[model samples]
Target: MPAIIYVPFGVYIVTDTVEIPVSSRVIGQAWPQIMATGSKFVDPLKPRVAVRVGLPGQVGVVKIQNMIITVKGATAGAIMMEWNIHESGQGSAGLWDTHFRVGGAAGTDLTVKDCPKLSGKVNPNCVAASLMLHLTPDSSSYFKNV
Candidate 1:
């Protein structure tokens, strides 16, 4: 049976990837954040996903909406989200009003004081992620107002 997961408005720190299974509907109130942190997501060459939607070759309904995804501390290799679910129908799988925020904000340790753009040099510590989102070849999704 399909399940509805409701996340309240708050900050959630995740040291590892959060996987969303098939036939699941995730709704967040007031734009809850799923923040990634830790050494596991620091290698740019071997990037890892912070949020994974469904397993490989999974065909079903997976909906995620009203959420904010971000990275904290040193996460240069973090891919904010990976979509791998093949939709069961035209509008079965999708994300709405969901957004991604990397760094340069509060609680991210990447403030403007730490990573100034006019500094004439890039600060490695301000590197938030390698990629924002990854849509696998086999995945099909309908995203609106993301």
Candidate 2:
């Protein structure tokens, strides 16, 4: 038989770090601010989000958090957002994760077990995803290296 990858939950993450110039730090924070809105998060039990503030004058924690967004079936998708706040004197970096797991046929969902692949490089900032859906050749795909 073929190598069947049966997963209870499927997750695809696109992590990228970002840097906001002191002149326009607000732009970098737009993503999280938008998610904070009530209409953004679909199911609280699924794609969870957590942020780490790194100020220009402050410190940044290299921590990973999943707010958890609810995935319906084998083809569910969710967007988890995080923020790293920094002081005006400097910029900050954060690891953003985007996971989606929705499988078909019998058994559990198609999760990225065994090969918990790491897509795209730790982005410079979340603004990259803010503009486009799939990455281009020059653009960063969620499954490429940094």
Candidate 3:
């Protein structure tokens, strides 16, 4: 049997697509968001918040930055990752509206492809992920804004 992890609480994030570096290039991708999450352990662990399902299309990455969140206590403690200190976005359709999770914490990781589609249609291409992660020491991680 597997360890039954539960995300009894969650925040909401929404975003749109725009241009990058004065050029018109849309960001559309299919990747499982690996948010820098912390778990209860002497040595830090990336306890996968195995979201048996995934986020919805209506939910964008922008909203994730300002989501009101609450964390359920893990073995360590109540850990929450802020979206204000990192860069993140939806792999597709962002209105130059990318953002970083001020704080990053452990949660779910999955794409529309990994879960059931709430849009009544199931197209792999239409699937994308919105992840919140920690920015590197260098600021070169973010996408150049136009």
Candidate 4:
């Protein structure tokens, strides 16, 4: 089974973090957006991400497509995609046609981490191809999209 979150095309100002579980997806209708409400933050640990997904040990197919995430405050990264160790040999994940921007002076564009027993390089930012990840034991993931 696949998990999905759908947002219609529009502008939305938010002040909370958007977390995605294993096998979950976030879809945008045309130009759906997720933006922050504030312009700054007092605490650094507070998340400023418009969308977040997955954990270090959750293995499944997670997708974020056709969505725009904007950061209005200086907090966490715009989007975070995490990968974990998988022995099931049947897992895939991707981010398609997704865009991120920072309205504030501080913030990261994106962060991709392979933790809890995974190694190698993960290239998820490119303009030519989409990001594709397979969570298998002793496997590496390489993504290129532009």
| lDDT to native, each model | 0.92, 0.25, 0.25, 0.47
Angstrom error of the Cα, residue 49, model 4: value is 4.5
lDDT of 1 at 95: 96
Candidate 4 structure quality by residue, lDDT tens digits, 38-58: 433223344233344555556
For residues 32-131, write the lDDT of model 1, one tens digit per residue: 9999999989999999999999988989999999999999977999999999999999999999999999887799988887677888877777888898
Tens digits of lDDT, candidate 2, 30-126: 1121122122223333532321123324333232222222222221123323333332222223223423222221222223441133755532211
Please name the candidate that would achieve the greatest lDDT relative to the true structure: 1
Report the lDDT of model 3 for residue 9: 29
| Better candidate number, 2 or 4, judged by lDDT | 4
| TM-score against native, each model | 0.96, 0.21, 0.20, 0.55
Would you list the clashing residue pairs of candidate 1? none
Find the 10 residues in a row with the least total lDDT in model 3. Answer: 14-23
Worst 10 residues of 4 by lDDT: 125-134
Which candidate achieves the best TM-score against the true structure? Answer: 1
- List candidate 3 segments past 4 Å from native: 1-65, 75-79, 82-133, 140-146
TM-score of 3: 0.20
lDDT of 3 by residue, 1-146 (tens): 11222222234221111112211232322211222223331112432221111122122222111113222222122122211212234332222323332222344323333344577775433222222222224212233231
Q: Is candidate 1 or candidate 3 better by lDDT?
A: 1
